[model samples]
Target: MLYGAQYYRPPFPGRACWRRDLAHMKELGFNCVKHWAVWNWIEREPGCFDFSELDELVALSREYGLQVVINTVPEGAPYWTYEGNEEDLYRTADGQRVAYGGPANLPSGGWPGLCMDKPEFAALVAAFIEETARHFADEPAVIAIDVWNEPHLEPMYDYRSNMLCYCRHSRAAFRAWLKGKYPSLDALNRAWYRTYSSWEQVEPPPRFGTWADMLDWRRFWLDNLAGWLKLRAGAARRGAPGKVVQTHVAYSGILGNRIVGGLGNELGDEFLLAREVDWFGLSSFPKWLMGPDHAYRHLIHNEMVAEAAHGKLFYQVELQGGAGKPGLLGGEVPDAGDVKIWNWNTISAGGKGTVYWQYAPEPAGVESPGFGLTGFAGEDTPRSLAASECAGRLNLPELDAAVRVPAENAVYASRSSDLLTFASERREEMYAGSLSGVFRAAYERGIPVRFLHEDYIGELAEATVRFLYLPLPLVLSERETEHLVRFVERGGTLVSEACPGLYRPDGLLDQEGTALGRLFGLGHREIQGLPDWGMVTACCEDGTVFAGKWYRQLVNPGQDVRVLARFEDGEAAVTERLLGKGRAVWIGTYPSYYHEHGFELDGGGKRDGTRDLLTRFMSLGGYGIIEKVEVPECESSGISLAPVVRLHRLEGEYLLTVVNHLEREARVKVWFREEQAFAGGPGKCLELTVPARDGTCARWSSSRR
Candidate 1:
């Protein structure tokens, strides 16, 4: 199911064509296809409906052992249908109709979005779902339906002239929702910083406000969008019984778009999952616009899969299939093997399924040929053949099943922390895309770390090992603090940055001896800001030199607490102590901020030694397993490479995989965790083995057990 294609043709093609495509897909090892019905396309030919093509497509897919995920088109429903209908088509501050831009914006006009509050729009979607489901429900190939693509606060442009719906419907709904949450408008106004005289006087917060208010407003907008999605999902499920309904959420990354707001996937996904979406779909693009980093790309995709895999197994619904081609923002084209490399990386990172942004290149568009797997002519070119071959090899049942193993270690990052530190104006200059850098550093070194959202910290604590990288201030709620204490008490390693336990969830300053502080053998004091090149030297008790920005305690350590490293000023920078069988390490600086300078002595100097020391400490802490391998240049860039190891039991024989991320030839040295002897092998000693380049299988038998 991880191998699939995205089909963008207008309504179903003929039965013969459908059968041919399905059979071809099966032969190439594709198990699924993402099918879409664009909103504008459906609106174009109103009652002149065509189900022949859809019926045949479904039938053929079923016959060929392929699953179909359908997307409702009407994404850009025609403007004529709702132009004069109501003020519901995204209402602007000055109120004007949103225009639909041909293929670009489709269906809806301009920047405004289709009004979900409009009864007519809901009815239109319901009808489409009902009719579409009726035609294909009997086909075993049909697995699910994507309710919509990415829907955010109206469109981006024309915000002033056409603000979001301030119309009666939205106003009334917001009031009702607020009333249910709060008893009175007075309380609401107090929390929202509103000076409104009455419920009618209540208005959406102005465009400009304090960062705090902006954050809240952004949250409100996400709730609004989620409300709309829930309504649509409910209607669709009612119409299509026994059908899985879902939607795709495009990764805005650090964009802070209102659609995601502060909730990110936590609340947003919870809402969708509650609405009965069978599977979640995420859009992931990891390559930097400026340069390529294979290791970083792998980490980004891995984080995406880990985060999105909260519900049922997630799908990489809009994977980039090719490199940038001639386009508005044209750049270097992806090397021949880029597509295949990224695809396998997606799967290795826990993606249950993947669908390329496009199967064939677009003839004309803002990004015509930049993201398609197949060329415009739809032929199996070299790149296509390579992709096909990779898919064919991975289709083996064993490899597919081997991907289900849960990560051994979990790493937590708060969305709020990511927003505060990584999304700030100085982010690029300070962090320099090092979130992935740290992740890659750990991954390439064979660390089995999985990125997790803070909301899921409790779930992660249940894993073998849990690590939290809190670069920003940690303001914990009473419940969260309790959770942390419990996690540490039960033999977990809690690693935190400086200034943790400084603030409460409500943004009030936490008293010094608060819950987290006493547990970690530290106290919050004045936080000193480190310039980009400032440095603090920490000489470890073990004689290791550590240097970095100094953020937290001028540590006066308590009994039983070990000062692992200290500043040149003799103040502790890294401290470790045991509480029960559990352990805690408090790093009073952010090592993940590789691009920034730390506290120093009057002049600029790089302070990266602390980061290096902490990395080594964690590696030796038994937190993860590490190994090294040499991959030849041909298989190194432009393609994906993954060393997959499958173990049946703690003692059972396992399969090892060395994938080539190239188009033609590749030579690689696969290194795996040294295996200890089992009944069929030597004693408890660990050992490493390599398979020959041309060998399909290699076995290393041990002499004694």
Candidate 2:
């Protein structure tokens, strides 16, 4: 993985400027560059080809020793490529065009989204990719290719746009696919609540009948998009053998917004980790709307990227250009050092590389404000300079091995659960919006968390980690349940939330005996629903106080287990017991979410306290202990705070990290456990060491026999 910036030169494109930009990128210690090649520009003029600018840009990048991640511009084939076929475009329910019309009457609006179900459309896309790949294959600087920009739901007035494809071609293909699944239109109609007389009478459902119906449609849409990617990947590989093929997914799902579409767990995981692409990429501009806790967004992006890649290297392909008014939606601009902080945060959270959206600002373009590391004038601003310096320091080879700390536990999230939550009508209020609080809490506490898909249970079982945390509402498939049982039986500490065994694979309620139900010492006798905001005040058996929101488990603990915390209503919020050679801790409530909100609501909204508890829990579980750490102050305003820590490894060595989040800086005193003795080493007993400011590094040797 390499750190770099996005390079764009549209209105003002010259060889000299391209050379200068490449030189500037090199000076800034950028080893990679993300460049875009728009489709309209390529297919606009028949015989008058202009490779002068691109050729110069590629040559300059190679000369400067920078790798190139090229983004194909046909972003939804150009209007001319679609040949004015309305059926070749996304449509609304009423069959209206979902694209904007250009002055030339081309379907030039709304990101040029192509009708993937159209054979002609796919042929044009394949041709475009082949042409682009053939042209750039010989360029030594080109290391990877992004076949398309962000592809998802587009807002066009056409009713066809309301759902996904309903064009003639799409309807035909969809019917065929449905036939493969159900064998008959009558069966399909029964499942989808339709009364179609024949295959030709079938049309896309304008409105979904049930949650299951909507979920199935969502699955179909994902398959459609995945097929497009497959087509593009096949073309790119055939044309440019051995080159890395990748795609970028905007972090809307990470930000608690499902409106942008693209982040479905199963769809995204399978497509991204496919053998067709050597690498996968995710685009993020956290501070845009997330405010200072942009660190949380950075962490989530890394986790999701890591999960999507399934342990392969993933890139942060699009970091924010600068602090500006949020375009399209309202968002925040990071303070002076926020960009550097965010860049580091991304790396610390598992990003192998960082790439800014643009290297220099565009004078006149559709996304001008969103362009550039520097303004339109190309001055080396403070942020740009800081970013360059950070990149330089990060490129140090020793830092690579030194910075990575292997996690001791895996956190598994099911794609089925993620998609179920996303496609649910109540997704906005219930699931999607609430995940950030949990993820943000874990990050703020410096927990080395990795997102794992349910399918990777075998990998989780093989890990040397002492414990695994499975957060609540885990609707399990039989395979997942069996994997969990085996993992627990293998001496791995398993922690999960309540209501673990509920749903079957066919979306049916499974109330009979479940695989792990007895392991959890609970059964589905009652269901509890609470307000969006409520409290679960629990008193631990050890007399510690903890409070949280959402649901809790009413459990009948086995004789071998001990209840940790329970609500006043007698429901268990946290419980622990021995399973196999190890222990299992079940947290009934979503503790991470509660911690994020910090049990208070000021004008700025809720704060989080989940990190503190997680830190303490992991520490108690003998994972790793925090020796001396600075504790951040809780602010009256709604801004998030950072928590810094100096952790002592079991071998008596120390690992120190400064997590300077937004708003407040934390300072604390170091304390050692009775059994733990400090090993004398460089910076081990330093009175004051600033990891964030001076790039302080610490190492300790074990004194244990």
Question: In candidate 1, how many Å is residue 289 off?
Answer: 5.6
- Candidate 2 local lDDT, 312-348, one digit each (tens): 5666778776643446422444444666666666555
lDDT of 1 by residue, 254-331 (tens): 222221222322223332232345666666544423235443354354444446556465667776566554347545
TM accuracy, model 2 = 0.83
lDDT of 1 at 120: 64
TM-scores for the candidates: 0.78, 0.83
Cα RMSDs, all models:
5.9, 5.1
User: Best by lDDT, which number?
Assistant: 2
Score each candidate by Cα lDDT: 0.53, 0.58
Consecutive 10-residue window with the lowest summed lDDT within model 1:
256-265
